[model samples]
Target: MKIKEAILGFMREQAYKPMDMQELSKIFDINKEEYKTFKKAIKSMEKEGVIVRNRNDKFGLPERMGLVSGKLQVHSRGYGFLIPDEEERQDVFIPSSFMNGAMNGDKVIAKVLKEDVKGKKCEGEIIRIIDRANKTILGVYEDSKNFGFVVAEDKRIQYDIFIPRQKKGDAKTGDMVIVEITQWPEKKRNPEGEIVDILGKKGEKGIDILAIIKKFALPEEFPDKVEKFAANIEEEISKGEYKRRVDLRDVRMVTIDGEDAKDLDDAVSIERLPNGKYKLGVHIADVTHYVRENNPLDKEALKRATSVYLIDRVIPMLPRKLSNGICSLNPKVDRLTLSCIMTIDGSGKVVDHEIVESVIKTSERMTYTDVTKILRDNDEELIKKYDYLVDDFKAMEELFEILNHKRLQRGAIDFNFEESKIILDELGKPVDIKPYERAVANRIIEEFMLVANETVAEHMFWTKTPFVYRIHEEPNEEKLHHFREFIYNLGYVMKWSNEVHPRALQDILEKVKGKKEETVVSTLLLRSMMQAKYAPQCVGHFGLAARYYCHFTSPIRRYPDLQIHRIIKEFINGGLTEERIKNLTSIVEYSSRQSSEMERIAQEAEREVDDLKKAEYMSERIGEEYEGIISSVTSFGMFVELPNTIEGLVHISDLNGDYFIYDERHLALIGERTKMMYRLGDSVKIKVTKVDIDNREIYFRLTEEDHEDEELEIHDDIKESLKSGIYEEKVMAIETGYHDEVE
Candidate 1:
């Protein structure tokens, strides 16, 4: 209360004047009885350094203001923000010109310059770069006469690295390569580097994978010694090893994954108990049994953290022999596994569970497409063609429907998304792009795995065992509020409050089901939420709406899962001491950070591949008219995604026969001469104008009615509202007519 009074009092005194106890009492307009109390407040303020006390019994500004430290988050524009890791509310702002060699994700110290706004965080300038996350640069090589330059793939790098000729080694021009940063010049904008390794040519099969690995500073290849060590691991499952664990070899366990998936990580089995509860078994590949702790293979796995799933291939954390062979839960083979067996009631609530080391013989391997057909179609001839899987598929389908309903009743959100799959030819070119199918059998497997993971997490938490948890914290309150405002503008109401649960957002998603703006709203809602990350601390998962969750189902692909398997095994065997668990507390946190970085790199590489494929697909379709929905809006243009999953930008000039204006806040492009508008999610027909593969850009134009087609022009008011210079540059249209007779 006193601090508030001081701030208000200081604001009133604009001139250079100091306040004494007598003057402060007059400002409060207090009686003589409270004069002594007001004097004590002034003395307290002086002691606290809120105001400096001079020898004349007057107070003035202190020598120093507020200051704080946080990790620097540098954007592509060169400006940065210091996001305090803990309780500091206001982020320190560092202008682009003040960022002293601070790269993105770097830890830095900031000196406060001034407060940004009333009650907001203070703005500051980055004075020192305490640390850098950019140790290695992944770029395309450009060879020169005496030296070479590495053009960074990351747009945020802002400058090309000047590589020394001697350090170029075998790197060739246009090769995707990794360069080590040797020194950063004090005055120059660019940093000097040396080419450490040549990855491959751009667009090559493995180049995207290599680029992502280098981007995250993750290792691409397994070391020679580690590979040798993994190669020596026998595929044989001995009887002695099986005797000490649960033997689920006789149970009808199966693995359901994508047709292209080779590294089978988990298998599942289910049975109804006498009490009407289901006993679900999640059998995960026991990589720890093959690769011992602290060995070369284990060490490598820890460093890599998790498997990178690119568009076409997977860069596994462990060597191929371990991930794809010895530890893979392939069908018809006896494999060692860390099993989480849970007994759940009809409501999908777990009543009992156990983490057991086991040997499982997978009965069959199923694909999502095959199972989807069995469940959706009743064609007698088709069923006869796949008679072997008909019965098992039906059983899996029934179980999935039951569990799904149970999950829904328990307030779980069903965010069924359309995932894209690339079909490649022998030459590695994308022949077709299709939506990935998620069948009932896949859902069955997923449900069983979720139950197992939750059971394991709950057990560990209750036992007070130190372990890694997959945590998804709440979203930023301001972001959620903005999302609510955006949704309200789109004629959809969203419920939000400081005390709202994750389930509340799920409720909004359910209400928007089948709406025209579902995709846009869903995408925006996901952006408003925080990302899930690995941590040693326990926090509820917002996306899944689960109190306890961990990645225990994909050990072959995720290193953290493998580590969890080892920890569970240690605890089950009663071999872990207090010190061992204590060490795991820190180990989990480190692995979580590394795993998150790997995931980010993988996502970037996946996007690159998707963009390339989209460009290729749109190349032949130029000038063909197709209906599409506006997916995004920008100052330059509106992006529309065709039904084929290809998105192209429609320049604002082409919005109508007239000029257009961009409403930045509302994200709409209005016609200048006309009042017509093209906002996000609006449906319109667009013809493919151009496809630039090198730049990963596709351009489109609105089809007009001149002689052969029907079209509408922008409204006059909308056209008149447009600002000049909105379309300063002219966009060229692509020639779509085929030249069969030109030869």
Candidate 2:
């Protein structure tokens, strides 16, 4: 008899309330002889401690099954991994057949079907889809002669939407649209949907932006009701309201930002005391004053969680009237603000701190360019125009310098690189791409904001008040090892062990500050570091080297700041007791998730805009030759980025000048006949062979005659592996589904 039959037989005989043998037999599927065998098998099950064959012989799942959860890591192959959500357990296996259509980022409930297989692996299936992470999808409308479909933009989304021609409405063939999935066919490969909104023609500027927004499901504008509410806010500060807050109307505070900045969220004032300490005031526009919790405007802001910043525009979390008008810390305007006043000694340590609600009048409104000029050259005329800022500016400069020194001493890692700033012509075409330079004024503002954020976070943590904190967990040791090896291939060495602290990485950065491979090394270091995220748990910020850190300065653009302000107020008003804090903790976690999603969407939008600009710029330059470096390598081809920052692909077939194999360990494409090699970070010359803006793809071809050899020196192990064909085999194994089977 089989184990199933024996178990059913034992259950019928010994169970106090005998389990229905028919039901048990059907569930396990067994015959009378098999039942006798399963009855004996129960002894083995009890010995293995898998279950307690009750007096009734019926069994129930262990109580711990309820706690089983993990991150839903969906694979490109439609299968996925069950990475333990607690971050402590080793990931479990979830076969493709058991996925049940769950995608990446979804939270799921899993049950342990079996324990460790030889203590090496755990296997499970998703029993419940606790939360579906995706709601909106971006796709191009495919309208044929009589039928239509929405071809999904996301490659992982295997199913397409069958759209009726009558419901297609204005969306034509190839027009991008935001389609909401109405029904998912249980047995069919396609979902049912209708065009919710027609986004414009494909590859058009407006449609490109909308595509980016839809890709992330990020909002592009405020709803009409929210906008109307913002427009109706009282613009003037009342005396009665002013009396309720601390008065700082006479303080020589000022707002400093980019020249085009409209949403001035924060202003600062710094002065020296006779006791040899500095008094620094950080006054942020109190967004909570105008938008209360659970209100329409507040709910909208909470949903956004953060502002999306593109190269040419900003999709603000709050309406313009709130972010740029009444709540903005504009110059000469009396604005209500929540202030963090700190008395600090020369050593950059806060000696005393106080948080207050205040009404502040700005003494000056200055741009970064103007302030930098005044500080760099002491432009007497510009300084004289803002007389009240003369002393305050000097104090600000001193404080920033001191803070910077302190930050360096405390192991704060500084990763600085040239960021591309596109200069557009009148027609919105990119005319020039320049590196955005950081100035003294930028550093000054950053230092002040950092300290203020740190102060607020520390206070919140100390009080045990629930609030959203900006946290960057330590990097993975295994990933850091790979990064170390990659950097070593570039002729640089870092003394990094599995247990090395981030400060060691910081020191390595300092050593490679101005070398030829600085940019590449920095890029690898970033890839090694963990991404910063918002959470209710207080983990010290790794990059800033701060014991506490939160987003408290930019309430105008960041919803987390506004939420933090509200939490702080509640704590001060004695409303944040243990129960209230518990409730707020869940809210913080949700906000963090929303904030992360919002940022991912914003980044996609920015990348789309950049890709569109690159395509537009390169469309006219097809077949034009340009100097480039091999930026990336794959089995099929290599990607080259020109000095202009436009990346194009060199397909494997184009390298037909010689038969080549991808050398994985050496990060190169090797020719079988000529031994010619192209490695990552190797400078080369290529020509634009094709440009496809519709696909957001660019193609390049290596010149047949151009050969500039600069061998990228590598470790002997990597070199030997590449020469012995071991590296190629490994690469092929990874690319050809070998790793997937093991995973």
Candidate 3:
């Protein structure tokens, strides 16, 4: 073993004590000839923060001394949290005063000062810095007579990059620029940097998104090698290859997606079987077949992980030639696919299934709007135009309802939050922000994909093969307890015995569906749940209430789907050899982690762009008045969301009548002397005061306020949910679907 691993392994012992260099050298039997090399290794580790040397001339791991090593995630208000590198460790909170010059996204060693008493995280202070994530800052250039500064777009980075006159390059005031840090920040001093690249003037067309792209460090273009390799791949299927694959060209499958969607990854085909079961076929484009393992195209796809769908643009994981051409299941064209054909019964149970490499010719490309109009509105024109597909659309809707009911019966938690879709003009300026509505047509596609993922995941899991699974573990007990208390104050009860189940949460969501407090309660409940991630193990998905689930539908867009496609093909062709199994075990382990991290970055970038565009939209209407609902109550302000799903903050200082104090337990703010309480779901009126496009923040001034609670009427579901727990006896005594088993 390397000296670093040996050192850590030795220090991990429960009985081992801190020892001096001489003592460690003796324990590892280090001879005099090799002592210099050993000493250098130890010093290097100490500098990198893997190990620490104490003032007492002793060496040990930092955790042994109550020091947590993790990445520091800072807040806009200067406070931060240390998300530990080790598993099962709670995040350590660091107050602003103890930041010790650590900026956002810095890797550091923090000393735990206090364990949390009534909260979910612990308190700590940064004691040492290991690595800095922001080697370059992307922001707007602020000019000065001699030296300039770059004000970062990320508010969490409180410090501005100081630039010397000579290093300003051609960047001018208000121009978005990338500054390479020349010096790190010290006590009460900002980091110094030099302007490297000037993007364009702030507020210029496309400059906003370009700056965001740099901030998130998203890969903008595929390497030429990857592009060349993708271009060189023949789009046509070889005759020899088609002979070995299942021929499903006459299956009457169709690709259903948005009108603007270019890369259609999955197609669905359904038929009534003679055995009184529904045969559902989910055919995903065979991306892995063309992008071979360890090749240039495959490497780039793995690095990007998932396609990033932004409001105005899409940062695809694969090149357009592959993702939108050969690998896309376009209508009336032959495409290779990894098909999961399932035999589902009336109860939405998959009784039989078959997964194979298949060649299919999709009959039509159906858009969500057209399908919804035909099935839901009974649009005579659309129905008549697609007369032959009316029966198929009705069948899809029927099967979707049955499958959705089965999922709900199994206690799946469906969060009904309104997702905002920002509409941009021809010049990339936000025209409006509207909630994206999901109709029966959308649900049909979703249900089909969900069932296919479960089927593939379960089949591979039972075979004991190595594959990437999408798993959502249960929430933390402390967070759940806190959530239970908050809901109890809101006149709702979480029914669970021994542990919390998704049913207990879903019951609450169903009760508050259209109520005024729906958004607040739903947001809180979703926050209390753990975030799902890609894993090598099938720990079950809590949100879907699914025992087995994997992302197997979008290989053209998601790397994990492509990864499992390769594994499933291998397992189906023949059993995995011992050597292949070993190789795949390592591959999946690394692939899952990288894919998860990239997915997170992609999500954050997308949200940032949304916020930026929203701010721009609000900037155009700074003085307009609008009615809104209080969505969140923080210490410094209250967030009011307009009907269009745009949220703006009402700073506490802007409250006209009285000083408001935050009520932590009730999630409200009370006017101290006036006795006026502003809590979540309260109706209010506000006028836009200001907008900071760079920070993506909107400031609103309250014009009118409503003291009465809007959630006055209670639903019957809430009443039924109030008396849900019948597990007075024990675990088995509970007659709730929370404990129901999956097929």
Against the true structure, whose TM-score is highest? 3
Q: Each candidate: RMSD to true structure?
A: 11.5, 8.7, 6.9
User: Model 2, residue 32: what's the lDDT?
Assistant: 81
Cα lDDT, model 2, residue 63: 28
User: How do the predictions measure up, each by TM-score?
Assistant: 0.81, 0.81, 0.91
lDDT of 2 by residue, 337-402 (tens): 999999989999988899988999998888888888888888989888876677788889999989
> 2 or 3: which has the higher lDDT?
3
lDDT against the true structure, per candidate, is 0.72, 0.75, 0.86
lDDT of 1 at 485: 76
Between prediction 1 and prediction 3, the one with superior TM-score is: 3
Candidates 2 and 3: which is better by TM-score?
3
Give candidate 1's error at residue 571 in angstroms: 1.8
Per-residue lDDT tens digits for candidate 1, residues 500-553, read 576677777887788767766676677677778888788878777788998888
Q: lDDT (0-100) at residue 3 of candidate 3?
A: 86
State the local distance difference test value for candidate 1.
Answer: 0.72
Name the best candidate (by lDDT).
3
